[model samples]
Target chain A: MNKEVLKALERDARTTPEQIATQTGISMEEVEKTIEKAERDRVIVKYKTIVNWERLGEEQVQALIEVKIQPQRNVGFDAIAERIYRFPEVRSVYLVSGTYDLAVFVVGKTMQEAAAFVWQKLATLESVQGTVTHFLLKRYKEDGEILEGGGEKGRRQPLTL
Target chain B: MSPRPGLNSKRARSLISKRVEGISPSGIRKFFDILSTMEGAISLGVGEPDFVTPWHVSEAGIYSIEKGYTMYTSNKGLLELRQELTRYLYTRYGVEYDPETELLVTVGVSEGLDLAMRSIINPKDEVLSPDPTYVSYGPCTVLAEGVFIPIPTTVENDFKVKAADIEKRITPRTKAILLGYPNNPTGAVMERNELAEVAEVARRHDLLVVSDEIYDRLVYGVKHTCFASLPEMKERTVLLGGFSKAYAMTGWRVGYAAARHEIIEAMTKVHQYTMLCAPIVAQMAATEALRAGDAVVKEMVADYDRRRRVMLKGLNDIGLACFEPKGAFYCFPSVKVTGLSSEEFAEQLLVEEKVAVVPGSAFGECGEGYVRCCYATALSDIEEALRRMGRFVERHS
Candidate 1:
């Protein structure tokens, strides 16, 4: 068995080599050897927290801000959208074929704060001609799961003749 | 220069409206959409109660139609319904309001919530609400050009928002606090003392309290407290209640809001422009529900309690950690043992065992490793769901 692989899986990546070896029932030498190789091969990525932003007292606002941009003669609309999305407030950016050229998901503390951020920060940026922001009215579910509808129980056995 | 029709295009042109793009559809409907396409799929993905509308309630709607009550009522809705709502609030929660001056009946709690946000929120108002709450609050805040500040409540605290936690999130721009008792995902109910503390904070901060008590009647053991009933809170609170959960009339889409006359007046103006009025038939049925649907409500609550006990026991026995829900027909259990994320656990269960449940993260970012299984379904289904869950856990382990 790859001791480093087992060690990495046991503890979070940020853990020290000695701790991983102790936890994963592997030798420290093997742990170092495997982790180095794993990192080089791109098997282990960066560590992250399943952050509870709400607990942090941060007002998390998600809205889809649509934008219409006129690209310069040499540069394209993609180039313009790229520049707009470079701002920290923009969480996600996508270019689509529709009424709007680009859709941006933005987060802010308040509606006015978000509006100011967009108007002063995004709208004034070069290439942006017009923008329409649609606030998400209600989210029944998100991230590929249902938020409601789990109280009742029904059984379904596969048809076995 | 525009390209000619039928010419080769360098980029794909979008036919969809700019308004529609980037606006995610309701997550609750996604399961039903997929369920509809799949043949022989047993779904428990709906949010409403499964029972049919009580007989007397349906008859009231029929009687109203027979009496030719078809013409549109006032923009704020039927005066009589508002009067009854006022009475109901007073009788149930000791909250007082002038029906004509303070109450406005909407399509459902959903519309009331939407109208409240639309009328009050300008561009980026910050709305404080508890995490793992009813799904609509966050999205509605976004749609109304407001920020959703979710206050995470843990199972250890029984999912009740701590007053201290609320104080931490408050900023200069924070305008309102959205409260949902007998909360959706966790079924955690707040007692009167807890609510009083929140009200005290709101009073001190001059923040509006949007209290959603849709599941008020379904609460077990804990007495539901109306935030507006507290002194000083009466002026700043906007109360949302409905007949959907209590009377098993989900499809009817009927609910109402109780607030100060000024706020109600503003909501009525928005309601007039957006939706002329709630469906007359549904309103009629809702009126009947308020008049005489206590027995039905009790019966449904009884069934839910039974299932809650069974499901709670099963979950604890199967090595899953679960806290007994105080209200609403849902059970949130921790699936940390299976070594899978909530979504992965749910997907694997559905695919391998034909059981459907929502991942907790679907409610908010903090809901990872937990899954919300609604207990609104029949007892047989709950038993089987538990059985399948046990088998799945064993296999995974």
Candidate 2:
């Protein structure tokens, strides 16, 4: 696979295959073939956008829950992680190191809904021993992107020496 | 009633010094003045990178302020920054310099250029430079009371100034040869063998060589040859480099000059007297750039390469014949198809299409008939600008 084409897509998924070919010095057919193969093999899992819901006044409440869980026979934490991740409210699940065996990112329309998911659903899991929920207060950055104050206005003048 | 008599226009004009008076304003100044008032204009005019200085580098500078390191550095520069810069040069170019003696950091490559001119030039001493060069080279020499001789370079030669062409302009009073490559205006990079020949010419003429390598790190595919790295040339060459183009640190105003101790001492004398030092904050930032900014520069170079391809292909497809610019983020496309002079084409394009580009003649006489389109803007802007230019070209051609 052409790693350059993949990198270009990773940076901006909207970049056309034609642009990728030109940018990476690959032939158009070759770029298309590589991208097709990558998608089929699930190398490119998703083409996603990072939207600022706060700007739209539709900000969703989110919280991180550190869960202490008992290991199942021969499965370690994988079975528990899979069960937690399968929940609709869970945004992400990690088999973490340290005091907690699992870290779950739970999102809901409201803080009460998120807390309900943590208490009624997550804390009552068969293997879950205890949990600590840290509700996200405000996001300055998310997914490697700054959330605010980055305007598209040009900084330098139109002419220079 | 006549006690408050005022000088007339001619008398007032005559009151200015001959040196400053001889230097006319930049040819494109009036054009840019018009551009400043026009809203919704997309510019491919300025040579600066569109990217902000990498956050980590800026944070390092800001961190210094938090730690209360805001005082001016030494007249030469911060010792650590100088050492870091010299080490970078040595490791990358295999050219060694004594940081304490041979390096003097100035405000920017702008100041580095000015310092080199003032240090080496005497009255009537001619400095030969490639035509269609950076805007400051000739004016700086002239300000130093030196004659600025232009060696006319053309598209036929791919804008690389030849040693023989440079030799033709030499005379008894010629004291230096000035070169800026991976050049601005033309985006021409002189190959190593070609520069070895120029080094030979300098040796034969026993002339000082001032090489402006501000865009050195921005070259594509091909490697950049440091002028001082040439055999027996370092002693006589004034090497000027900066973090502006490569590191996107133009507003920081920090650059450096490297040479033999004697020449550097002379430059430092002038620098200390006129401007005491480069801002300490800038030096700290430059030090961070040298230490950890390579990956950032590499990523930027790749991005510029992509934009360069899009621009070169788009311009050629639209009938504006353009040479492949292998360095810097610019495409110097000949606007000859439009049947208008470069200035006329630029003015009409801005007014008619709201697309701004610098007219080639603003660089030098040989730069006529072409316009420099910087590809450092966003990909979307470049594509849009090309569309507007295509329409403009179709109508004019």
Candidate 3:
């Protein structure tokens, strides 16, 4: 694993290859080859942006759904987890160990749409026994970024010893 | 003797004491004053990190306040904080200090440096330090009633002071040798073998060595050698370290000094009477920092290393000859190619291109031909500043 290159890209996916080469003291060609190999090997799955939708006056609703399911023959939670993750509305799915068997994150344009997904799709799965849903109210942080009050930053004096 | 004409203003100023009056104001102050009023100026003048204190460290301080733990700690500081510091020192450098007797916490390395000088210097004593040194060292020595001696270092030597240069400047009244590496202004890191030679000079002369390691953790691709950790040197060295640079906790005002028991006792006596103790909330935060600050510091260091490389290359690419700084966040590039003094270069750049840099003369006499550019800023701002500086350099040269 070219951890240094990966770390730079993970911090800011838009960082250019030349910048990575300068930062990690690797040659430009090596950096390009390593990134290409990593992408081919699936070490880097995808590059995406974490947008603050509220700033644009867009309404978005997100919810977490805890699902309970009966284990099927030959394929336990993997089969059910895969089915839950394949939905476009489901942002993420994880096999959790607590009282819940699977934890699923679902996003929609409105609260009604998100709640409808829990009732219409998740609760009606064949092996699903029960489910609980919690709607997210506000996002104080996402993807390691604080979502508020950074406008007041850069108050440090222009010059200091 | 009779209250002479109620004192003219000039006489009144003189009454403030010849020592304080003789000390000139910092060279950095004048440029920064001009910078403050300019609109939309991009500054590479500040010497501090751009990151805020990590959220967890700040949360710990808030938690302490909620618990009503807002009382003054012991004169030496909270025992638990001291213990944590000793463990860190030992683990990192193999140097052990007694938490009870050998460590004293202060407001910052600023205060620790002051206390160290006050506790050891006597009238007419001489304190030898490298030229192009931190601005505070010379003033602090003078304030402690000691004579400040400068050993001039050059870019040819990568700004590392030679032991022979130091030995030649020593006099019978010389009391201590002061060192700050990963130096300010120059960003030079002293190699271990070179420092051992300097330590030998101190040992032979039976002089104290006061080492400031505030930027120890900021070195790029090089290991920092703790002067006190050198063989047989711990007993004669007073080590000053702080959280300001490493953990981005400048406002917390927490730092420490470690030495033999007697030295700590002496510094503690001065600290108790003048400042009382570092704030209790800051102490609590510092303790939390020692416990959980490693990963945060590692991330910040790596980020700084990247910026350092970019700034180094940018300065050289623009026709300014810059020595590669292996430590700290500054790039001291010689601006002599422009046929302008360091101050003139800084002033003209701010006026013409709106990019502010500190004149290297602010550090000391030997720093006249260079200007210090700090890279601890946003990457975009650094790039923009470099573009502006390139334009300015092109016109003048």
Candidate 4:
């Protein structure tokens, strides 16, 4: 099982355990067990997707949702935000000091959807008192990559069959 | 104090070199750098049109030089050109400005942006803009010592910034708003009604509006609206426009800004100190562009619209979810099926498939799970790129 997991990582960190088993001649059960252990031991920190939002006409609208929450008796603000993050729309949540208690990142299908998510969902939470959303006007870089650095490098090549 | 030679060795200015430290060399540039060095890479990441400068436009510049009109003109540019600009704006978008007082020719829209920020931004003042927008705004604001306040517009509603959303982000420090129509990355355009809504908010807040309309002529079905053209916005709005995108004169570096006399005066002071004026020959070429360039612009827009349709249809056919872009030549598609982050997907496509694309995250944080594909390439190239992308998706799936 350990050898199978090793082979899978070597092939592609993005490959799933189910795929690993099929490719490495290992049972799915053993692959899953090995993957669980690897994750528990901090080998795989995360899994992510790279989307071409431009192609989907999906403009990436990011706003810092500053939340001022009413701290619960025993649970505190952290507990309240944890509950808020359960929504798939919430991308990231942080405990911040100063004027706001929490900074949340939310995604929506449109400008209106993002606004609705904040006004109707996140803002309506019982513990929430006030919310301020700052929408990103443009993105120069995200996760350490540039968007419009020019020439052929800036071009998006078509996929081959 | 002078006795210890090692104790005071200039401290090397705290560690990171200033050149490499604050200047986060454009992420797009770095990606291209990597691509240039790699083998078998085909890229559709560039933002501008692939067409060369129209022949008539180039001829105008050459004519100016042949006629010995190479000397510097007035700081506000040739009167004939400014008047032509005034007429062009009025006819094209219903925008009005006193060309003599309100307009200042600059090197490009890039310089206009830099000049606007340099003129209006007091240290720590806030400049509001939309997210996943053109890449230069935030960095320019920072370089001008102004705080950049980004308002994110998402994929769902075609990436338009709502007036209510804009209102919520305003604060005492908010001094201005930067508006880009026929926007970059998302290809979102604001109709007249939408511009009016934004104009009302700016008026109430007493905010200065910097309107970037470089892609004005590229709108497919929608009419492009200028914020300054609205009733009250002209007084508070600085109009940034250029010939690069429309005339395919990018390398010529010619653009102009129109604003209230006072604002123009301030921008000119900065412009005079930094750039003097746009190139003389280029200005002559632009003058001709303002006059006879309309037909050329129309022809290019028609071609782009056709290509845009082809690419959009191809993307949807390939099972990738894409929004219909109203302006500009880009398509932002969601790459969720592969379960790879924008960067991972881009890297793999480049390395394994030889297809080059920019990760959406390179645009901003919300740009994760996406990539921007420019349709400026030829139809055949776009078709090939889509096919390669479909195969890449299948391989990962």
Top TM-score model: 2
Scored by lDDT, model 2 comes in at 0.92
Second chain TM-score for model 1: 0.93
Q: Write the per-residue lDDT of candidate 3 for residues B189-236, one digit (tens) a residue.
A: 999999999999999999999999999999998999999999899999
lDDT of 4 at A111: 79
Cα lDDT of all candidates, in order? Answer: 0.79, 0.92, 0.92, 0.81
Model number with the top DockQ: 2
| Better-scoring candidate (lDDT), 1 or 4 | 4
lDDT of 3 at A136: 90
The sequence of per-residue lDDT tens digits that candidate 4 reaches over residues B310-384 is 677777777677888889888888888888998898888877877777777766676778788888877667778
Q: Encode model 3's per-residue lDDT on A1-161: one tens digit a residue.
A: 67888888999999899988877888888888889999999999999999999999899999988899998999998898888888999999988898979989999999999999889989999999999999998888888888867535647788988
DockQ for all models: 0.01, 0.67, 0.66, 0.02
Native contacts matched by each model: 0.00, 0.67, 0.64, 0.05
> Ten-residue segment with the worst summed lDDT in candidate 1 chain B?
B7-16
What TM-score goes with each of the models?
A: 0.68, 0.97, 0.96, 0.68
Candidate 3: where is the Cα deviation over 4 Å? Answer: A150-154, B1-11
Instruction: For candidate 1, write residues A6-78 as lDDT tens digits.
Output: 4345434466776454434457798788877776776666455445455466676767899987867877776
